[model samples]
Target: MDQQNGVQIEDLLKLKFVSDPQLSPDGKRLVYVVKEINEDKKYQSNLYMMDVATKKVARWTSGKSMDINPRWSPDGSELLFLSNRTEKMQVWTISASGGEPEIVTDMDHGVSNPSWHPEGHSILYQFTNKKDEENGPIIVDQLRYKADGKPSLTSQSYEQVAQITLDTKEIKVLLEGDADYVYSSYTNDGSGIVYVKFEEDEPESYIQSKVYVYEFDQKPKAISEIKGTLSHPVCSPDGRYIAYVGHDQKYSHATYNELFVYDRESDSTQCLTGKLDIQIGDVMISDLHSIDMSPSLTWSNNSEQLYFLASEFGNTELYAIDLFGNVDKMVEGDRHIYQYAMDDDAKDVYLAISTPAHPGDLVRHDINSLMEEPLTYHNEKLLCNITLSIPEPVQYPSQDGTVIHGWMLKPNDFKAGEKYPMILYIHGGPHMMYGNTFFHEFQCLTAKGYAVLYLNPRGSHGYGQTFVNGCRGDYGGGDYHDLMSGVDHAIESFNWIDSEELYVTGGSYGGFMTNWIVGNTNRFKAAVTQRSICNWQSFYGVSDIGYFFTKGEIGVHMEEDPEKLWYHSPIRFVKHIETPLLIIHGEKDYRCPIEQAEQLYIALKQQKKPTRLVRFPDADHNLSRNGDPAMRMARLEQISGWFDHYRLIPKTSRVANI
Candidate 1:
């Protein structure tokens, strides 16, 4: 077979991103979102349906805007989805057979997370209270007054749960207050609804939320009393139990969310996966999916077992846990199950799977036989002639002797005795794992004649809780050594790598590490940092979750221990940076905030260091993954060009080889 061309940045437009697979009540059909780039270079997600028996696929929506969060009606006669077809996101219902979608809600604020009433007469959705006037001076009195990619809060606007009747289209506020309410699910008996809300009107209150059951015509009752952030409440089929995913915040945000069940009769909660030592829920990262929906716990019809997705060893697999605390891995592999929807019978599952070879495709898995059948070929034609770099799993001992897991991709069109530049790629989240899933950026680097090295450092979640929390309060300490050692091991093990022509780059936490690496050493010829935090003091106030994130990750509050915060910040050591650096940030990135990038870029320029800053307008923290297609491509090209410009050349010899 002839070697085809490698993947280019422009090819992103041709690839189809799939997500949010939901099964019909009868389990005969599957509804999912197929996100593709439009002529305007913006993403447009439309609803697609698949026949479970015949494997036939068809588009259910033809909207020019995003049509997502598709939920099946109780009778499976209509599909309720959130669409912005009218220029504002709202609940829209379409016949299951495919027809014109009817706008159900006309609320001023956009709606999300739509759930149909078991009776199929009304819909429960979430939307923030919009101010009466549109144009006015902004005034913020709360600590968390602004969120990334959202309008600045001039007045307090809390996310409230509401219901809209299909017949009259009359909207009624089911729950309202200063606190934000997120709709989870209705009780099995349909007597009340379950949701997660934070009622304390304080800055610190944003870090904690409680699961509540709001009974009709009654006050809400708290089900779980464990002191930690809780979410994804799911009532059992018999209404005797409630299952949710949460942690005790023992390690703060570094703590893995464990699956827990609340016994309504006993009035107690138990951690079902206490011995699993894995993070529950979807932790897989992919650029193919515009929105990675949270994992929903599915209950067996008998109500004896619960099924959910968990991250272990860099892979997200489906697992089942019984009421007796016995856990079983239903699906385990090197691939990533980004999102899955279980049938009502709980015997089959529909998954959005991504492997090292392909971006993503829909598939059906049998719970008993574990057999998988592919359902969609959205990216088949595009990938037919495109060569992808397959990653080889590599493991090495860190500086502290702890084993670290990683993957390395060799440059495309490799030849014997040929040397190529190497790039070390670090993942963000610090808690997120760099796993077996396909990474377009890493492949792009290899396509440009550069070997790529990516790994799950100490703070990554695939390992146990201890390993995931090992980097806390020790940023740039053990974790830094782990990354550096991985690079050293890669160069020593790969004889074709040009050790002298090394480059480093990462985003978010990885961006912070990139800054720290360049500031601490000059070994790499070039470095690129994206949406990185440079100062903890400012980050604590400006970032959406910084107040708690900094305290939890750094193990100290800014006011309590300013010295420690500054000690770990990379900006303090900027005077020592010697590598040619490029900074990339999204203008609307409130998680790390664009100021984080601006501060670093300005400081480096003041010292006359080789640096450039590229900002993407109308983009948030997820620019590289879910931002505008044009901006994402520009980001890839910028990073590639910056490294190429500063790449070192191998020494030449006059003698010719025979």
Candidate 2:
């Protein structure tokens, strides 16, 4: 808790990210991945284990490699994980007791989702059946041709599922063909494997995806009765029920995912968390963690109570749901538990948690007694000398009189006599929550003497379904006013804040709003839009998620309502913008393609508006979060530098300028 120096962009490389806490079967050992940016400006993670009894810690995998996705054998005798110690990421195995590791798979495209079989003899994993692009033209007829971070070419590959035996090293392809198998797991007896298959032959592949339970020598049968997208399907230990996280296509991608259990005995799928009104996953937006929208579901050993993580009003906590439609909040706190794993009987659980003041660390919690204990201090030393800002939870009435929840952070060196400049940060998801998590960007801004404000607007998760769907067809309507109200409330309530020195910035959905705000009003001094969209008409074809996302958000397809799309587009209002705007985007961002930035930049220049576009080469939509270390820091520098260039503070005592 050092207040001498605030958190700077250089600290981004020094922070350690704790994730995917996996408990050993015997409940005596803990294994998880600790990722950090090295001096080389690249991410490196390795598996680390800790003894639950003595609280002792040791490295399971070492060296400069991205070793992750660790899973213990059924008996806890051996462990398998994916590692890039070699050229391409492949499966590697090591004994849980500790020993030298050995490679298992050598696929060209690499393998992922490594899990042990029921008998603990083999491993099941996923790989792409990629066709050689050099051999011929990469022709494709699928609508889902390109994706963010993927090669910019028509996909000539299909997903395949396979298993490898440890003793014989024999590999068998269990599932393959035209469809993309996204997620997979083995049943209790290892008799069948439940996997989510996205059939790419149709136009509505994202919606028509079904969860199938494929048994060896038997055809894969659709177990999910609902016609919606699902992932991370886990079969019960008794093989009686299968639990997964997803939602029907009622709201498409914007739908709040609910936990559903498919009963094999009755052949019926029941929604377990329908009455809870919470998204069944960690939907909080954090730059410190990976981009994992897909939530995980873990069933109890008895198969009666299923444990999962959910977001409610900006707090992601652990909950347990039983068969009788009863849900109990097991671990409630104002913190984000992004990843957790339970012991054999689902009693002793380990959680990776974070808050505003702390980066993140692992904690062990007992399910029955609700007792908790800290297990790791991975970021303690790195953060010991860094002064971090603690967010004050705030709420205000929106334009519709509905209450909007958010957090406000004062500058690191705040004074009562001074007028502090403020910046409003809008989260991208329009559906993701700016929750009680450690955001490196916000802290960095505070370090440079700027108050930070971020709110989970209408389309954000953690709120109820209605609020999340509030912005679906009404983009820039209620969502826009909600943010403006928050800003107005902050300025009026706080006497220390200077309303004239205000600034705004956001990414993706927030980016679009930044564009919208500058176009609509001249209140803010400047604005920064990252990985944003300006024209919906063009975004529909270029963005990877454009087709369905546009239809889902705007409630119309490209041809269905061109005028309506233009009406919601920010580029259409470029002529009204007066604020100096900085457009930051990734060149390889398929989520919000570079063309989106291109259109807005050209339009602003044509109007002779003050604007500049900064594009990071080879970076994707996650440039601000999980991009290369140096690039991430540079992006932060650009954002802070832009705001400081228009510094309304009168060139006072500066903290550290870039």
- Cα RMSD for candidates in order: 3.4, 3.2
Give per-residue CA lDDT, model 2, range 1-658, as digits (tens).
4345688888887899888888877788889999988778789999999988899999888888999999888888888999998878899999887889999999998888878899998899999898776765667677888888777453677778999998999999998887688788888899879999886656867456789898787887898877777778999888999888888879866788878889988989888777888888888889898757656677787889888888889888988889988988888899988888887767777889999888899998887898999889999887777777899888999989978989999999998889989999999988888899899899999989999999988888888888888899888989999999999999987889998788999999999999998888877888999999899999999888889899999999999999999999998888788788999999899999999998899888888877899999999998888888889988999999999998844422321221
Model 2 lDDT at residue 418: 96
The lDDT, on a scale of 0 to 1, for candidate 2 is: 0.86
lDDT of 1 by residue, 1-658 (tens): 5646577888888888888899988889999999889888888889999888998889999957999989999999999999999888999999998889988988787888888888999898898886665576766676767777675552468788988888988887888877788855788876789999864656577768899887897898898788788889999889999899888888988898988889989989888888888888777666664334355688898899998888888798888899988988888899998888988777788888999888999888888898988899999987888888899999999998999998999888777799989999988888878787888887788889999999899999888999999999999999999999999999889999887788999999999999999888877878999999888888888898888789999989988999999999999988888787899999989889999888999999998977999999888998988888899999999999998877643322211111
Model 2 residue 603 lDDT score: 87
For candidate 2, list the clashing residue pairs, or say none: 430-459
Q: What is the lDDT of every predicted structure here?
A: 0.85, 0.86
- Candidate 2 contains a number of clashing pairs equal to 1
lDDT of 2 at 607: 80
lDDT, candidate 1, at 445: 85
Best by TM-score: 2
